[model samples]
Target: MAGELAGHAGDAANHGIDLIPIVALLAAAAIAVPIFKRLGLGSVLGYLAAGLLLGPSGIALIADPSSVLAASELGVVLFLFIIGLEMEPSKLWALRKQIFGLGVIQVGLCGALLTGVGILLGFAPVVAFVFGMGFVLTSTAIVMQILGERGELNSPSGQKMVSVLLLEDLAIVPLLGVVALLAPHEEISLTTRLISVGVAVGAIVLLIFLGRRIMNPFFGILSRAKVREVMTAGALLVVLGAGLLFQLSGLSMAMGAFMAGVLLSTSTFRHQLEADVEPFRGLLLGLFFLAVGMSLDLGIVGENWQIIALSVVAYMLVKAVAIYVIARVLKSDHAEALERAVLMGQGGEFAFVLYTTAVTAGIIDGPTNAIFTATVIVSMVLTPFAIIAMQKLMPKRVQPLDGVELADGLNGSVLMIGFGRFGQIASQSLLGKGHKVSIIDNDVEMIQAAQPFGFKIYYGDGTRLDVLHAAGAGNADLVLVCVNKKGDATKIAQLLRHEFPLVKVMVRSYDRGHAIELREIGVDFELRETFESALQFGAHAIRVMGADEIEIEEMIEGVRVRDRARFEAQVLGGVTAGTGLLLSNAEDQARESGIAPTVKLVAAEEKEERAN
Candidate 1:
């Protein structure tokens, strides 16, 4: 009877759902995320580290990783939804050349090369093809998160990376179909396959058309209702509904979610929807990455460490070289091309999906699938380190200034130091008003590039007084410090204020602290680089939410005036700018400006109540 009871308990433990692993996973994340972020390794790596600690290979605390992974797949779906929401249809259309052109060539060539490698390793042709296709994909979640964190998503290199990843996502459907054909599964007729494809296309079109028609009104009502929970639920429903529609029609759920996002991108509710779903997307995606770490098979890795290492090195080398060649062919500069190659050299999350599909379809046996999965995981685990290494190895290249000479009497009323994006904008605006502008920058490449645009930029470090004198800073009416670095800006501002005291200095600051430092150095005209842009964005958002234009403009102006006053007051008083001080000053300013103090008080009270 005791033995029978123990056996029954064992059965119960096996069959019954347990919450311990879930608790453990959350606890691991709670501890790991902050620590990793503090160490500057990022939260994705933190999740991976947490998973590694609690996984079967570590303490064996999580008995069933597949269950955790299954639940975490929702993160990927939501991630794709957010990505879609951020992208407009027109933008996607604009990227069509890169998406189809560079993306297609990268996959085709990478797939072929990896397949050849697999064949030489003694795998059958079908298995080699599966391996090649699976390995051609780089980790979209990891790459995007890293790049987005660095604020490079819209940069040239970032765009190229995104274009390639987009194509890979689209290519999954066809790749799966190919795997199905290669396997000994029950054969469907060619006509039926074609019909399936057509149906999938029709479903996508129907989704976009119907979504565009209904989503705007639906979100409008939700926004007017002003129930945050209801709005959040509505957002989730839209994403899941679209994802399910696509899944039922034999397309990727993520693909469907992306389509839904594009349809809603132009809606006024876009920002609200993004705000509602961002927290969920972030948490779930972290969980997804944690699940990936848990899925790594340490036993297999231990047994085949040498082969796994060789495979990973070979895979990255091959993909990196291929991607570099492709980027150059697509007109990318050497630095941008190398960055793309390094950023995209790892196997992606979809490898797990594809490998499972192949195994289930009997195209690849269990052992081969295990090896391939292990290889992919190892490559992904090393990707962040690879990115860091590549960045360190490939410093930004500055063009040579050989044979370049500044024009004689290069004196202008406006002396613009730094010919980067910020400097260019300020210079162009002044020039548009018919001001004579002389530009100076340390980046020789930038000066060379700007020459074709009729900009006569002198290559020199503006912080050096010799370079400034050579550029005729003494006779200039105003000196605009538009350098990229805060320290450099401050340095040039000090030099001008001390040496050329008569020349007015207008400096661009990176942030609040930098602005304060500039003010301390007696630069009267200082502009925070992104401050006005952010305020303008906020104004537009308020307008979209039904604020009157006149009222919005007045409110913006009042806030700006008050902020400037408060900043000056804090600097003069030698008080550090903290949240409490900021709020107190804002309330005082609002009262003085005859704004509604009750509204501000109520908002603050509500926020405190929510925190409680």
Candidate 2:
């Protein structure tokens, strides 16, 4: 009876102890993330600092960093899955040249250079090769997160980096095989490596088959259930299951999750799955960074600071130079090549995996592994700062506008600013009616691209009064402001309204609020950018829902009339003056009864209120 009582007490104590780490982590993140973000250091560095503080090498709040790191790897797995969601098969095919061509060359070159550096530092060729190859696999999470923060993940340069990361993830399996072969143990045979490779290939094939055949149907059934939690659970199951299959096959779990995501990229549930996985991905990824921070041993660093410091500088310098040269040789411009080099200069999380495997295979002893790991961590810590410094120091390069005409003293009946999609479509009506239109845009690439398509777009900033005058805005009968940015469009509208009041202006409003603002500025005409398309979309939707075509026409007209009335009301009184003019299903039912009177009464009240 006494022993049973003791066991219960011990269990209670253990449960309580578990909550402490949870509280500490949450508290640390709440404090650290905001401060770091405010200071412009970013959230990753914040997590690392928090982890270092909570680690055994510091206050010892978390005893085992290895277990935390192991569990936190799920963050990386989910991160890859989300990345895969964005890469449709078509998009993947489009990036194949960059992935296979640019990626292969960068990794090959960097690996060779880094290995040479290791050998120069007195390491054996095999050991140096392992170290060099490990560093070649840059940190996908850090680079991706930074790219996302800067809104560059889909940019051409960012896409190239992403492609290289994918190739690196794929390289891990073969690298592991290489490590096995180089091990002192005679049992590590070529046959074992071949079996592992075969198993990995079979697993990938199985994942692809299941994803294409089963995922959509499975999601369809869960969606029908209409239980939100169940849909979220289903998403998690798919991610975790794919990861497990790859892990069992001795491949990267992240690669498996990525494969699953790509398979589902074309499915109807793609957006739903991405939304469900996002929250978990964020939390886990943060924890992963924290775990990495905790794993950094001050004892090891203090013992071998000089060697670790020298190695980090040498490795990063060699890797960065190689990447920059390779990128330049492949036709990337100077600025882009420099940015890529800085962003990918650091060794990644995979270095830990490689070094751990090396230790197990008797390739390197514990102390050497510790020193190498420490160097990688330091490099990771230094990367963000390096990028910030580069951004500050690097001079912005102006793109050469070769084969493109500048906005000179040309005159046309209609002056169109910005030759983007909207401006292009808007110009057609004027052109069809035989009005000469002069189009000006600041985008050199867009202007050059439009040239082959017979668009004589000249390089000019519409927001600049001098450029507008040069583009014949002063003499044109009709001035069309069609720039995409709200600020630029507004600035041009204001400029034309003040400088060339004789010319009638038609401006593209970004939204309803922008429409009101534009109207207030007294432009001759203004149209919300998406207003017509959205109305047409709604009309089509109603038609598809079995509404009579005549009734749909009436509804569309009613909406347009109501929108116009609301805009006038809003322009007269404020944005709040047009509430009663909004058309809803409920208003549709009451339209014949008292809706018109109510709208009139609301408009009158708004006028009176504004006057008062």
The residue pairs in collision within model 1 are: none
lDDT of 1 by residue, 387-439 (tens): 76776788644534664455335689988988788887777679889998888
lDDT of 2 by residue, 1-612 (tens): 334534654586777754657777788888998899899898889998999988877677776899989998999999999889879899899999989998899888899988999999889999999999998999988998887665456667888999999999998888988898889855756677678779988998999999989999999899879898999999999999999999999999999999999999877676679879989998999999888888889989999999899999999998999999998988999999999999999999888899999999999998999888999998988898898799889985444567877788979999999888999899989999999999989899899889888889888777766678789988899999999988578768867876788999999989987787677667999999999999999999999999998999988987888788888887755578777877445544567676553333443455598899
How far out, in Å, is residue 59 in model 1? 1.4
Looking at model 2, which ten-residue stretch has the lowest summed lDDT? 596-605
lDDT scores for all predictions? 0.80, 0.86
| Clash count list over all predictions | 0, 0
